[model samples]
Target: LFKPVGLGYASMVIVFFCNTYYIMVLAWGFYYLIKSFSSTLPWSDCDNEWNTPSCIEIFRHQDCKNASFANVTVGDRNMTLLNISSGLDEPGHMNWELMLCLMAVWVLVYFCVWKGVKSTGKIVYFTATFPYVVLIILLVRGVTLPGAYDGIMYYIKPDWSKLEEVWIDAGTQIFFSYAIGLGALTALGSYNRFNNDCYKDAFVLALINSGTSFFAGFVVFSILGFMAAEQGVDISQVAESGPGLAFIAYPKAVSLMPVAPLWAALFFFMLLLLGLDSQFVGVEGFVTGILDLFPSRYYHRYKREIAVAICCLLCFIIDLSMVTQGGMYVFQLFDYYSASGMTLLWQAFWECIVVAWVYGADRFMDDVARMIGYRPFPWMKWCWSFITPCVCLGIFLFHLVNYKPLTYNNVYVYPWWGEVIGWCLALSSMLCIPVSLLYKLFRGAAPVHHAPTPDLQTPRRGPADPRAPPPTTEAAHFVRG
Candidate 1:
């Protein structure tokens, strides 16, 4: 839809749309945190409606007059648990209060990252590290529960029959977790000093990310085990994924623990921090990309705070759809379609092709060597030129062959038009490369040139020229040549 306008604008639109969803998710974490404090056991029962018999029974002894639980009705019967639905959909109304919370989150994010790296960098020291502390706390508590071992066993014990599926899922998870094709990493790295050892940084970050994922599995399963034991159900019965895991099952488990309110608050607060960290980087990338497109003089004078505000405002307005009664439906659509495996694989494949073929891998290595004072191993070049592209292409083709229609809660099948819209969303990111290339070709644009360094411009004295005069200075060489 944005093709005719320009690639830069299209990129901005994509970034804005994606960031709005991040904002919505961050708001969700805050909503749960606020709810955690209002009630001693907010997730004791899925149904929050005070008029309901279950709600009355659950809260009769406690102060049941709290306004937070007053008018909330159980909605959307797709993922029913304990006689309550996901509360994501309510036939024909918008969740105006949730919308307000979402707006508030956008405002918070604006201030957190408005100063760009200077502010966000400091914030990351906490936002990034605090999750581990919370996770460890939860892990300790989880393992101490009666049936926590069962949950951990269930999590680690693999089914050999599902090996192929496991490999595919693992690859997809790693790619997304590392934010490979989202352009955030690239934008963040651009701020680093030219001679920084990005090679070392990449490995360290990857290890940290993968390690956290591993540790989190133990924490999640241990709590899930406890839930299963308490309910007299199998671990499989209590296990859930995505929003079901975060918003429903996990909260339910936390409410059963001692000092439930405190645990819930800590857990939800950790979630909020993690979401904020992700949003900080995403918004930073969006702002950086826009500034790079505009004049450098304007960027210097106006700086990023104004751009940050405008982006936040626009994203807040766009994200209102998610706060509606059908907002979760829209959120699911965006989640399944945008930043999907297919799109990421497509982007990765093209990135490999561009750097390894079009831009010349050998030349890239030369630049890297100049910056880092040592050349990368030959294996990296081979991976860039061949292995990475092949793997990406293979995974992408595999996904196509095994494509399934999008669904919600494994029950609500999206309509044909909804699936079409999803395909369009997936294609939006994939088409940027080819569409922009075609546009440039049609406009007769020339490839960008990188001027040679002064050292490179000066010719080295050769053994064949032993009788020749001393090598000329760089300035004299440039003047003469």
Candidate 2:
């Protein structure tokens, strides 16, 4: 397929928006990780300053009005600590604790990747493996808990209606998990030797990624079941998804375990590592994309460090809004729009067209055969050529048709202007594709005569190859090497 520089640029833009808000989750993790050092888990009881009269103790889980785990009870409504603020309009002042944690996270990321791959490689040894160890420990403990079986059963049982409703969410999860259209994998993959068996690596990565998710489900639901049983509630009542699950339900469940603080520490530490690992790749992708734009000019003179620092600082500043009392509302806005499933699907559709239709799926297979010594499964060709694009386009249209305004905690609907701003965020990245094309078309591009050589001994030049494309653009330079 003819490589479109804008598509690459668009992917980088998506990564930037994703990394900006994504790292804020790590700050929350840090806040909880630090709090886990306490004699008792802060959210385990309704005794803390943040707790309200509606707060219910974890062990005495009685259904209050609109009750949620380990938080306030309003009339008959139960609320968690997460919903303390009435809505987006009430975003109070900055939370100093979370702000400090956000800074700490950025600093950690800057230090880890400032030296580029050297520092990143060393840290991955721990960041990648430690999560599995914690997961295993948690899974073992979760299974042996009083109501673990109930949780496991809840997880295994399928709710067809719920699945139908959330199919788009499931698609987005797959894209996010696989790093599709993010360019992080593309940037990282560029580091490999030309002859590396990426075909094999792709399958390995998918298997491991999906396997980890399935295994982690057991760890989560088992504890959730135990919480439900302890509280004399249904698993559905105690089990929450996303942030509510991580910050509220799971923390409350762990508090009931023996040595609650230790369990809390381990769980949050795992989250910290997971967030850090993702942050590393995302930052690296963004940095690598930016630096490569100017090739030979910025490889020295501490340029990489400066780039990393500036990126971290900018994201940290923008993230300040998320640490406010009303920050969760802001977080929801970003999460719902920035790098969302719709944006990803739009990108994926174009990618499939460029590769499978415009570029020729047969040619791609041939290229893969050249690198891996054999073509991949024939089914792959069908997937790229027809199945993938059609499916993405179909689901994307369905999502658009059924779209609703943003809401928080299933209440507090966002204002019309808020929805406008969210669409702007989504289009900011999605528009990069067409914008880049127009830029290239108006600026005029030299057709690539051949693929770029991989030799990196020279700054902008590679070993002579008749098949190599001229180094006219950043993408061309990348292809050259």
Candidate 3:
């Protein structure tokens, strides 16, 4: 009864953390895209408090605090607003090392996509996946840092405000971060044998994603501590502000270091590469959904090479804005609307309606037993039917009760138009699910999910009823004896 419920709960949590980590990865990608064309380092003493006093005198009147506007000094002159407040104009204010890391990441991503879907499949052995490696690296490096404990302590030392904040953040993070309902998971699942144990695989993937985030605190936080020590400030002050932690905190670290540019590029590059994995998956999800829905579009045109090429062309066209200065904005727009809250809520809702109510629990389980060769526990059964729907419904209700747009910096809100467009695009992506369900329902076409059960040819014995006069002759003989 509760087996599916547990799956729901676990999938939700895993999805949430998955989104958050991916955002960090996105930031890293942004760093490298910038680094590729730049001649000098993006950050410099030329842009900060190190700038001379006269330069600072020019923009002293501006709202530097809210603006993150700052003064810098270089060669006997103070330059204010030359750089601005703490980090780059970009949120998360990343560094070189992170940027370099992002480059390596994207290069791998591009290469993986270059050949087509099959190539991507081949790369999965190492490239199309491998975040766990970076995550483990973070765990080790984080705990070893001088002020590692502070980040961990602070992370959970919640203010009630953060609960409200994190709740929303967590929801959105899960929606955008996870590629489940968007068709990535399903499409990926398609690659497995018809009877592949998807429920199990989903659970494993979700665990890996969430568990890493929990552990990532040590890696991410320790670095924050390292930053704090250099700035001679409390850990809280230098701590990651939000999902933008890497971008903002990392740059400051590079700034403090004597030989920063090299490290800065590397760090930011790594961050960029990390994003490619998630980003490509996101792209792939839509591609798969399209191919699945409109068979004629590929019309058996879905050859891996041809399909991959077309998808690449489409991605290039859509992603062109990412190459521009406003690319970050595009990423943010996608991030806000395509959040886990929205995706999972819808996934949970429809998955329930289709599997539980539409197809029937017995049928669903039969499918599972057929594919996986064993029945899910009662709990698992219940979740696909009930728990997942409840949680998803709850999240959707929460959003309707309280929703807001993604803000620029901490305070600047996106316009209503941007919000509307974002939601529209987001809604369009999830539409396939309902369309599929309706088609299956109306056409009576919910394809049989499980393998056909082989009929038993021989008569099976029921346990003898002890209450019955079992084998009267034998009993009588025994009594007589």
lDDT of 1 by residue, 184-285 (tens): 666666665555567766777788878888998999889878766665556665566676677767776776677888888888898899888778778887
Q: Alpha carbon lDDT of residue 163, candidate 3? A: 81
The ten-residue window of minimal lDDT in model 3 covers: 71-80
Please state the error at residue 50 of candidate 3 in Å: 16
Which residue runs of candidate 1 sit more than 4 Å off their true CA positions? 1-14, 50-91, 297-300, 445-481
lDDT of each model, Cα atoms only? 0.68, 0.77, 0.50
Candidate 3: tens digits of C-alpha lDDT, residues 369-393: 7666788888977887888778778
Q: What is the lDDT of residue 362 in candidate 1?
A: 87
Top candidate (TM-score): 2
Off by over 4 Å in 2: 1-5, 60-84, 439-481
* Candidate whose lDDT is highest: 2
Q: Taking the tens digit of each residue's C-alpha lDDT, what string does model 2 give over 84-164? A: 477777877788888999999999999998977656877787888899999999999889988899999999888988886
Pairwise TM-score winner, candidates 1 and 3: 1
- Candidate 3 lDDT at 283 equals 48
Q: How many backbone clashes does candidate 1 have?
A: 0
Whole-model lDDT, model 2: 0.77
For each candidate in turn, the TM-score is 0.83, 0.88, 0.67
